[model samples]
Target: MKELKHLNKYFKKYWFKLLIGVLITIIARIFSLIMPSYVNKSIQAVEEFMADTISLSEAKGMLLQYILVIVGAALLSALFTFLMRQTIINVSRYIEYDLKNEVFDHYQLLSLNFYKKNRIGDLMNRISEDINQVRMYAGPAIMYGIQTLTLFVCLVPLMFIKAPTLAAYTLLPLPILSVLIYQISKVIHKRSTKVQEFLSTLSTFTQESFSGISVIKAYGIEPRINAELRVLANQGKDTSMSLAKVNAWFFPLMILLIGISNIFVVYIGGRQYINGDIESIGVIAEFILYVNMLTWPVAIVGWLTSIIQTAEASQKRINEFLKAEPSIKNEVLQPTVIHGDIEFKNVTFTYEDTDITALKDISFKVKAGQTVAILGKTGSGKSTILDLVARLYDVTSGEVLIDGVPVQKLNLNSLRNSIGAVPQDAFLFSDTIENNIRFGNENASHDEIVAVAKKAVVHKNIEGFAKKYDTILGERGITLSGGQKQRVSIARALLKNPQIYLFDDCLSAVDTETEEEILNNLKKVSESKTTLIVSHRVSSAKNADKIIVLDNGKIIQEGSHQELNAVDGYYKELYLNQLSGKE
Candidate 1:
């Protein structure tokens, strides 16, 4: 219910449409209920003829009128059913669209830490399966629910009027049915949640296996991977079977209750007629018709309850996602544009659940139009510093300032929009090469795309493809080599033409010769914008205007290439080791 309440934003927009739909549904159900009265009238007319109160021809005429009334009611019921589906069910679709869009929008606002902790498959499940479950509640569940409720509202009093004692006896099983539904609904909710969770696990496994299929093939471990996949699939199947078992037990009990109620009506009404307490067979026929009318609507309770419970579970998951507070929130006032003057004032950052700080009391400043290279070993804080600059993560202590304003206080979109970042692992969608390069700037011309590709030293390789820029890539751009992916990512960043640029070991996959060539081409691109490069190779950092050497999360040296090369420290040691390896 809380999850449904959270959807009030969408409800507000479509409430009027839903109101009109409900009215139509109620009118339709009323027409259907009135047809049972026609049955009563027809029987009454026949009874009158048998008692010599009416001629056979007159009774036949009355029966004919009731037959036409039944036909009209049936036709009107079908028409409103169509109208309600068009209105309410269509509204559910619109709301689903709105809900999915909002969830995606909120996901974009969340900090990188959130993605680091959450799986892509789990998020995908919430978007797809969970949202669809919510839609069922909105559409078919609510539609039938209203129809069933309307029948009770219209038919119950009429059932009493036809024969109060019979009505009371027939309804005797309902309170027990209510209790059974309440208890079974709890089990359904719990089992449905487990099934959904297992489904998400299966989704995660499938996504991971497909994404890593190349590695599995290269390692010749398909059997091992398949075995692992089977484990997850089996778990998913077992949970689903468990849910089905509960449903299996509940449905029969529901059918039994319906049968028991009907049995009571027939027995009690038959006895009353024989004992001469009732008027005639026509009255008993009307009472039986009313009970039959009540049957399906009451039976539908089991189905509607299941839908509602599933929705409740799905909504709980969706609400957890929606209610998650983004670690980063942009609440700054009139934040000035970033001119790429970045500073870290004794910044310290420790990742969640880690005792040691990733970046310890780090302080540095890069002026506009400067290229600063950070050189470090495997676990050094080079990438952490760049992460702070992009505000992918805020500093755990101290401050990061861009153009004199605190990075935290700056507008998030404006801040991120100002920077272009290329990470070590280049990820691209399955799309045309042209589209991948144009991802940073969708409005970029073909000429502009080719220009950036050439600058990143990837144009020649792209031209070698069968369709050149139009060549479609596989998942994660896996059709391309590692070096090609890196070059494409670099070209994507180059196309952005941002105020600041960050390259975190993006040249690692390329050969040193190709790396040098790409670096030489980027000299012009790096001239006016602030640029930060995190690399382990001396070739990548040797020509930088400034170099910062880091070790164990602390800056060990800071100077130009020659200045650091002349020093007797970690930088000098790294230079000597690489130079000797070359010789």
Candidate 2:
């Protein structure tokens, strides 16, 4: 119930549609209630004619009028029901559209650490399936719940006026049903949450398996993965069946309770007529019909209850994320293009919930339009340095500044847009080569894309393809070789024409000769931009204006290639090892 409060905005936003739907539903119920009275009248008219208390012609006219009223009521009920569905269901769809958009927008605002903490499939489930569950509550469950309430309001009073004793006897058992349903609701909500969680797990397993299908095939571990999937599939099925059992039992129990009420109506109403307390059999028959009207809505309570329980579970899950505030806030004095004089001052960063610091008092400065290279062992905080500059993760202590403005104070969009970074993984979308290259700058001309590709040394490879630049790559550019993917990624960054460039070991995939060629090409473009290159090979950083050596999350050495070669240290050792390997 508390979780449902999150939907207040949507309710207020589309109140008109909700109001119209409710009004139509009430009208439809009124029309439906009216038909049963005509049923009573038609029965009495037949009784009067058979008793010869009324003339046949008069009786025929009355019966014909009753039939017309019945027909009219049925038609009006159907029309309003259609109108109610049109308004309410469409409003639910609109709400869904808005909610999904909001969630996606929040995802964009969230930092890289948030994504690192949450799985892709779980987020996808929230956007797709969980939101859909909430949709049921917004639309069909709400509509039918209103219809049931209207029936209860309008029909209950009519029953009491017609025969108070009959109403009392039949309706008294209803409180017990409500109590029973209230108790069952707790179990239903619990099981529904379990089902949703298991479904998320199933989705995650499927998504991960597909994403890593190549690895599975290469290792010939398809059988093992399939077996694991079966376990998850079975768990999902078992949980669903558990929920289905609750539904199966709860609905029939509602029908059984309603059936008992009907029995009470027939038995008690029959005796009241026989005792001459009631004047006519039609009264009893009318009460019976009114009770029948209550049956479907009452029986459907179980189903509606199930929908509500599922929605509550889903809303809780979604609201938890919606309520989360992104740790990184985009703040700015004034939005401006960065000149990219980056400085990390006494920076120390520990990831969420970990005592181990990834970066410890790391300090460095890169002048505007200068090339700085970083060499480090694996897990020596080389990539962490790049991530900090982009504000993907904030520093635990000290500050990262760009052109005298703290990165945190700069507008996130302005800060990120000014820098071009090519990560080690070289992720690319499943799109044409030209489109992938133009990802950083969609307005880039075909000529510009080809030029960048040539500069990255991937243009010749693209030209060799059957569709050339138009050729669509596989997911994450799987169709491209490792070197080709890296080069394409480099081309993407080049097209941005950013003020700063960060290359995180992006040339590791290419041969030494090709890497040198691309580096030389990059050197020309980076001459007017601040550039930071993280690399393992001394050859990669040898030509840089300055090279910084890192060890255990701290800078151990900082100097030019000539000075570092003269010093007896990690840099000199790394250079000798690479030189020896080449020989």
Candidate 3:
């Protein structure tokens, strides 16, 4: 209930409709209860006519009036019942929609490390299956609960008012049912929670298997995968069956208790009538109808308890993430723009998950409109530098300054909006070619997309596809070749035309000739913009304004390409090896 307080704001928005639904529910139950009383009066009129206390036509007239009133009450009851669902159940749907959007928006604001620690399948299950369980509480459980309460309030008093002794006997078994429900409810709560957890685990396993199906097939591990899935399936089956066994106990126990109540009404009420304590057999018939009225609401008590327990379990999971504060907070209260002057001042960054320091006291500077290239081996912290400039992660010990302001002091959205970064791995959505490229600049025209694609040396490949720019890509853009995917990512970055361009080894997949063409095109287009390129190839950095080489996490060399190549150091050795291979 404490976690579910998050929905109080949503409930306030629909309070009027909920209030109306409650009023309608009371009216509907009142009309339905009228029928049992009239049924008794109609029987009394028939008996008076048989005893010659009234004319046949007079008795017939009384009976007809009673029957007509009973039918009219039933009709009104059904009509209001329909209106009750419209107001109450519809509010639940509206709340469900609002909750999903709230969760998804929070997911977007979280820092990158949050994604690294969580599985996509677990995230998907919480948003989807878990919310569905909560919706069951919001809609059906609440609706039926109101119906049950209304029935009990109206039916109980009427039964006792007609005959107090018979009413007491009929309700004798009810206390036992309440005790049974309490004991069963405790076990149901424990089982329902376990079922929800297992669902998340199963969803995570299935999602991972589908995403990595290519790897499974390539390694010929189909048999292994199948065997593992069978184990999971069996476990899921057993877990569900355990829950089903508890739920299966609900209806039978309710019906057996209801049967006992009915026997008490008929057997006990008949003796009272024979002994002249009661006036008519019609009274006995009315009691039977009252007992039947209690049937459905009582049956649903167990089902409703199960729903509330399941909803509470799911809300606990949702609240865990909803309450999580983002590690990265925007320090700037107002909008701030960048002029693309970037500097790393003795920055040291260690990954929290692996406890590996990716950068150690690394210092570098690139003035506005200057091009700097970083050359390094794998794990040399090149990509980490680009991520810092993009502010994906904050520095551990030092400041990353942008346009003479500490990166944290700048407006987070404004700072990110000013930079275009192409990561080492080119990830494209399962969308059309035009749509994927337009992701960087949604309003870019067709000619603008074509222009950037030409600059990245991928226009010719797009022309060869049957649908050209309209061609749909497979997952992660597997439909394109490795080089084509990299170029498309470059085109996307180019389309943004940001003040700062961070291209992290984005041209590595292209042939040297193609790479040379793209570089010349980049030089022409990026004349007055800050550019940082991370690459292993010497040719990619040969014509830069400045070059910085990293070994392990610290910078080993920094100078112009000509100056570095002239010396006998790490840069010169790499240049000689690459030049020999080209020759």
Candidate 4:
């Protein structure tokens, strides 16, 4: 219940709708109460007729009136019960939507470090499975809790007013029932939390397996995957069954206690009637109906508690992420203009998770319209330089500046929107080729998409397909070849037409001839944009205005390509090696 307090704002938002539902539940219960009173009256009428206190015709008339009133009251009760669902359940759905959106929005605001700390499937579980449990508390549990309280408040006083002694006997088992439910509810809460945790584990395993299905098949490891799934499935089933076993105790216990209550009513009432303490048998019948009326609300007590405990556990998980502060905060809300004059002065960065320093006293600058090529061996910090400029990872010690202003001081959205980056992996979405390209520019026309595709030298390849740009790609653009995916990703960035361009080995997948053509096209489009090219090939850097060579997270060589070619350095040796290979 403490964890569930997180949803108080949502409760306040829909308080009016819940208030209406409460009034309806009360009115419906009152209407339902009319029947028992009428049942007593109808029985009394028969007794009067048997004792000859009234004419048979008059008794028949009274019975008919009572029957009509009873039926009308029952119908009114049924109608209001329907309205109760419309109000309370619908509010639950509204709250669910708001909660899901809130979690998702928070997820987007979190930094890359947070994603590194968490799993995709676990994140997905919190938004979907965890929120669903909380919704049950918002809707059905609250509705039934109100109904139960209403019955107890309205029914208890009337039961005593009718027959205090009988009421006393009938409610004797309730205290014991309450104590049992409290003990059982504690167990239920513990088990519920375990079930939720296991579900998340199962989800993560399934998602990872599906994403790596190709790798598993390539290695002929289907049996190994199946064995791992079996282990996860067994654990999941055991947790779920443990929860079910405890839940199984609730309904049977309720029924048994209710049956004891029924026994008390009949046995006590009969004794009273026989001992002349009661006026008529009709009183006995009315008390029986009263006890019966209490049966459902009482039985639902255990169920309502179960739902509440489960919701509390789930909401606790949801609250954990909601309370997390993003590592990177937006210092400026108002938009700031970006001209792409990027600079990093005395920058150093260490990966927090692995504690590996990706950059060591790194420093570089690119003017508003200059092409810089960074050449390095794998793990030599070339990508880290581009990442620092893009502000993906903040520098551990030093400054990242754009147009002489600190990068952190600038508006995050404005800065990101100004830069177009094609990542090392060239990721794309599972959507139409046109839609994937349009992700960079949502309002881009079909002609603009085609134009960028041609600039990236992928237009003819796309046009060769039957659907051209309309072809649907599989997850992560799996439907396309590695080279085609890289080309499409390049086209997406070109479509953004940002002030700063980052090509992170985007040409590695394509052949040398195609890479040359794409580079020629990029040179045209990036004429006045600050562009950083990270690559292993000497050809990619041979024509740049400046070439930087890095080794082990430190810049070892920096000069023009021709200048470096003349010097005795790694750059010269690499150029000669590639040139000899070309011959």
- Cα lDDT, all candidates: 0.87, 0.89, 0.89, 0.90
> What digit string (tens of lDDT, one per residue) describes model 1 on residues 1-583?
7667876778789999999999999988888787777777888798899999999999999999999999989999889989999999999999899989988988888777778789999999999999999998888887888998998987888777778888899888876776686677778878888988888888888888888888889999999988988887788788888888887777677778877887887789889889887777666667666766676677668667778878878888888888888888888756458899988898889987455688888888899999999998888888888888888887889999998888888887788888899998999999999999999899999999999999999999999999999999999998899999999999999999999999999999998889988999888988999999999888888899899999889888999989988879888888898889867
Residue range 287-360, candidate 4, lDDT tens digits:
87887788778767766787898898889889999999987888999998999788878988898888999889
Cα lDDT tens digits for candidate 2, 131-158: 9999999899889999999999999998
Model 3 CA deviation exceeding 4 Å by range: 54-56
* Per-residue C-alpha lDDT of model 3 across residues 205-270, encoded as one tens digit per residue: 888888788899999999998999899889889888987898777767878998999899889899
Cα lDDT of candidate 2 equals 0.89
TM-score of each: 0.93, 0.93, 0.96, 0.97
Better of 1 and 4 by lDDT: 4
Rank list by lDDT:
4, 3, 2, 1
lDDT of 2 at 345: 93
Give the top-scoring candidate (TM-score). Answer: 4
Please give the TM-score that candidate 4 achieves against the real structure.
0.97
Q: What is the model-wide C-alpha lDDT for candidate 1?
A: 0.87
lDDT of 4 at 332: 96
Lowest summed lDDT across 10 adjacent residues in model 2 is found at 174-183
